[model samples]
Target: MQSTATSIKAYLEEIPEERKIAFTKLRETILENIPKGFVEQMSYGMIGYVVPHSIYPDGYHCEPKLPLPFMGIASQKNFIALYHMGIYANPELLNWFVTEYPKHSTQKLDMGKSCIRFKKMNQIPFELIAALVQKMSVQEWIICYESAFKK
Candidate 1:
């Protein structure tokens, strides 16, 4: 069976008919707002945009196969998550997010690993999240990504 669709563009099209509109809007918001260097692709069954390892050749000392980029998005059973590696990667960013968005109680936000899970598109802060993505350097993002998978 096909686990994950190959490209982000195709994954969006594959969303169930009922959820297409919502997912598409979310996808558009992400595409329109993220920094220029980022590129979108389908990863783990959802739409993900990454900086690609090529941009940061010297990023991670180990786990060279994984890309050096810093962000991802996935469609889960209940919600679509906009995984911001930048927010979870930096302590300062994590603190700011928790303080600024107190209402995100049910959703999970982890600075140590940087992922924001939302049941719906409305639950996310588009501008702030976009800005966070904008702020991360490819190298900084790679450090964060490496930290998460490290044992």
Candidate 2:
């Protein structure tokens, strides 16, 4: 499949008809809550958001390379994946998620560095997810994301 960088508007347009509504709504909510300088794009065959290095310069290990992706969203084979930096990155928020979300379950989620997989959208506690996304800073997210994947 052909893939390229795109905006959220473009990414939403490309989602298959059956999944468009739900995914678009989710994308909107994320955009509404995430911090300024966060961007949406298609990466790894999914809709993803990134906090570019220009926005979080102190957090970058190298300039003009490896700008971090603090959060991401993906439509997978069976379910939609909301890859938050919170899963393994922020223990406090992750603990809350584990306890608060009704049908959510998490194991060793390490896809491109610490992604939590959710089978059903409703199973997520939207308020908490938004809160976590908003509360965690880009540097915090980078720390958590990298720590999770450390070898």
Q: Clashing residue pairs, candidate 1?
A: 88-114
> lDDT value for candidate 1?
0.61
Among the numbered candidates, top TM-score falls to 1
Which 10-residue window of candidate 2 scores lowest in summed lDDT?
104-113
Model 1 over residues 54-118: C-alpha lDDT tens digits? Answer: 68555334555644445676666666666676676577877777776655444455333555666
Off by over 4 Å in 1: 58-63, 103-112, 139-151
lDDT of 2 by residue, 20-115 (tens): 666777777787898776776664556667766577554434433645666777766666667776665667877766665554323332233356
Error at 61, model 1, angstroms: 6.3
- Candidate 2 matches the true fold with a TM-score of 0.69
Residue 150 of model 2, lDDT score: 39
Kindly report which residue pairs in candidate 2 clash with one another: none
Candidates in order have lDDT scores of 0.61, 0.62
